[model samples]
Target: MTLPAIIDALQCGTFDREVLKMLRDGGYRCVTPTLGFWEGTLESLDSLARWRDMERENAELIRIVRRADDIRACIADGKLGILLGYQNTNLLEDRIRYVELFADLGVRVLQLTYNNQNELGGSCYEKEDSGLTRFGREVVEEMARCGILADCSHTGDRTALDTIEHSPGPIAITHANPASIFPHARNRSDRVIKALAERGGVIGCAAYRNITPDWACATARGFADLIARTVDIAGVDHVGVGTDFSYKGDDAFRAWMRMGRWSRQLNYGAGSASAPGAVSKPDWLPSADRLSDLVPALGEVGFSEPEIAKIMGGNWLRLYEEVFG
Candidate 1:
């Protein structure tokens, strides 16, 4: 089997009305944001300067989805629902107040830290991780109050644990894998992985091609293997697909990824051979992309039909409903 059309959900950049139409035309019901955002994007929402020019260039196809029911409804009606999220909190600045503001604007999930240390907490890319500070606690509290999911995918070890322990609402990790199987700072440990599952959260294991040791299970198969292993450790109900798809202009994207808040600052962001690099271009859309290949990949790993549904999008939908409905 090739794959299904329902996927090709969200991309890192370049969503326009024409893009949305093509996605809808392809029979896509919903498009999940494996990684919901970039720093320039959130800042651009308020200012039209650089982002404005970009938006105008890609006009008509961009949307920010913030609710689970919205996605279900859109998928049912043959439209695409964009799940609003972010890869880092640098866009939030220091004011935790922005969490609710973004929530009001339809941003549902937020990663505590991005590539480097922000005011809230230390990032995986940072040389030292001191965990969540008082300010970071306030940040998590605000996230709970606003009903936005607290994400730990890019957070440091201690910070992630602290957030998990303190978050009032169920937490969400958009993308990760087992560091034991493949050593990577972006990956999680068994203890933390199980903790997330026990805490009623979902861990989205990505394609992470760079992190995989086995060449045979590279694409969807590799993605599924990590998800399956995570499910085995955390249970089926705690897994989902967080592709970490960073689709955009290659040179520009790499520049952004390698830089800190300012340009020309090279940072060692987290990852290993098991993980995939960022997305490729601004014009790409995952909705029209073939994503269902993971279903068979799941089958190869002995995942039953029901488990497949959960890993694909069921668990994410359930959690999304719990917090964002």
Candidate 2:
């Protein structure tokens, strides 16, 4: 049977022709290349610079997705569609207008916070979640108005629930797993998952080792089983894959992702302080080239072909249509 077009909801890394080739080989026709802003500053020139770089460097191999139709068009043309996304609203600084500005620049996804509290709301690691602040409510409204998805991947439980309650439209938790499966700060709870799904939102399961049950449960099959369980909770229509793959290997990149100038000391955010580096990924899904293995793995987990297709990519496509104009 022919597989459906695949869309990764969130991946963090640089994009180049080689990466595009791997995505194409993996049967991924569309993906969200999420870049993060950590400094909590209004200067988003760096994000713009990277967007321009991807446009210039891989113009032939990939096309930036601005509209829902662009995804299918890019896939039919054999070009990977890049859905520009941000993991934090720090780039917005204090101005709500920047939400529309970033949307004009083709940013389709925006997470309210990262691993720490921001102007919008608190993070999962915060001592106490402040929930959605007044500014956060304004940002959510503006994002919904501008067709930018409100993401809650790194947001605290209260903030995430608040987003679901206050947003005019559905919101997404783009890269997370179930806390019930693996008790981690980065994972979502059943309450959050059900609320998101009830609001017409989708949840993308992450492949990060720390979010999985253990090193043994980090395989492609294991990830598939996780998705299966998520489906049981959130329904198949609201579950998809967000690998959260960071294609960087340098120590600086690792440290930046963890601390990102937010702390002077080493903050082992996800993994252990002993390592503070990239954790070992499953052998079945080390990179985008291995993403295709998920299809059969999902089948092995007893998902019907149509259900597997939705988990593979259809659900996210529907979400983009509803949220991204």
Q: Please, what are the lDDT tens digits per residue for candidate 2 over residues 1-325?
A: 4777889998876666777788877788889886675744344557667777877787777888888899989768888888888788878879988888888888899989988888889899998999999999999999999999999999999999999999999999999998988898999999999999999999999887777766424577877888888999999999998888777557787787788876798788788767567787766776777888888888888998998889998999899999975
lDDT of each: 0.65, 0.85
| Model 1 per-residue lDDT tens digits across residues 1-325 | 4223243322454554565566566545455543423464456355324333433554444334567766676666656556666667766767777777777766667788776777888887678998998989998989888878888988888888888898787787777777887787777788777888778998876554444445323455655676677787989998876655553346555556656446464443443334234532112124334455567878998888777777777787888788767
Q: Each model's TM-score?
A: 0.81, 0.96
Off by over 4 Å in 1: 1-11, 16-28, 32-44, 47-64, 214-219, 263-265, 268-288
Model 2, runs deviating above 4 Å: 39-43, 215-218
Q: How many clashes (backbone N, Cα, C below 3 Å) per candidate?
A: 28, 0
lDDT of prediction 2: 0.85
